[model samples]
Target: MTTMFRYPVFPVLPGLGQTDIPEGLSRVRSIMAEPDYMDGDSDELIKPKKLLNPVKSSRNHQDLHRELLMNQKRGLAPQNKPELQKVMEKRKRDQVLKAQKEEQEAHKKRSDLEIELMKRRETLEQLELDQHKDDEEQENTPEFVKMKSNLRRTKQEVDGQERST
Candidate 1:
């Protein structure tokens, strides 16, 4: 069944298609050229579309692509923001902080006064209670209030009296 190995190994004949090597290569057998697509038993036609034609990149192309990617993180920007930032830096370097501190102190004082006023303001219920508790207005006249404040005894005199008692 095997064609290559037979009962008797066929001797090389010079009359065949294969040619003998020259005198220098007495033991060497005949050589063969590389097999071609046209020589194969398969009769399939070549398909150019199925063939691969990949593009190869050199070092320069790869380096250019890497640089492009590295630089594309952001686009070009106007210089206005940098100028404004410089202005802000100048403001920080100037006495703007002192002015801001003064404004903050004034704001704190105003807020404290507002809180005191809110505490002094009477609610509707308190107002009604005051109205009903005394139908007649009390000794709340401005002159009477001023007289009471002026005639009020000194704290030292009151303390001496308490000690004597």
Candidate 2:
């Protein structure tokens, strides 16, 4: 003998594969839809939610940090300065201007020094060339030796006078 119930108050989905449901959801949904279902605790029905963009929230926090730092340096919020603040600003500006002028003067002095060094280098090179030419011309000339001796004596006398003064 077979016993059949007239109406299943909540339908019992047959173990799956005998229905119109999609393959993926067939097993899970069937179990869930069971009338006498007690799979586990009731709370497990809902999925554990998560944020899609954690960095987006961090980006907002970064904006707050930037605002805080900016406010700290430039008085509160909108850059409004009191009378003393204005005076301090003017003082700072004056100091910066003075520093810039000093820097310009230093640069000018450096350029002048470089120019003087170049000129001295050129003069030294010219003197070396002249001495080399004189040496070449003196190979057979006796007067060249006499002239060199006189020049050496003159240089020594001038150095002696400078040292004394």
Candidate 3:
């Protein structure tokens, strides 16, 4: 029995107007002239010179240098995983603190909004009370004589019934 693992390798090609290259790969050659789209037959042909350029390696070296500097600063005595863990822990703690601060600010905003709503409600209640008073005064005016006469008639009916009883 044979166990075989075959991984599909997909070549990332450049778009219509540009050449496809890895993220850090720098093309020293000017892209003034565009290459013709290679047909299926020409796809198998590998140009050694084109593949030999280490533009990506140059970028990786820079990233490696940066990592080295960070390690030096943290005094990561080579292969010591504890220091890396400490750095990661510190980062997590910082993120948590930042999130907590944001939450506190959100809470404060909600409280301020609640206070404003309460104040508006009080103002609306006062306005309603003032409007009610105005309505009462209007009802008492001379033009409201019909309503006053109706009330007197009802009172007379009640008094006459009481005397008869």
TM-score of each: 0.15, 0.20, 0.21
Clashing pairs in 3: 14-20
Q: Top TM-score: which candidate number?
A: 3
The residue ranges of model 3 lying beyond 4 angstroms of the native Cα positions read 1-110, 144-165
**Judged by TM-score relative to the true structure, which candidate is superior, 1 or 3?**
3
RMSD of each: 26.0, 20.6, 21.4
Most lDDT-accurate candidate: 2
In model 3, what is the error at residue 1, expressed in angstroms? 99
lDDT of 2 by residue, 59-93 (tens): 88779778978888988775466779999999999
The per-residue C-alpha lDDT of model 3 at residue 36 equals 46
Taken over the whole model, the C-alpha lDDT of each candidate is 0.63, 0.77, 0.75
lDDT of 2 at 148: 93
RMSD score of candidate 3 (Å): 21.4
Candidate 3 worst ten-residue window by lDDT: 25-34
Cα lDDT of model 1 by residue, 10-101, tens digit: 34666753344443543433334444565666568563465443433567777766776666666533344667789889888677888888
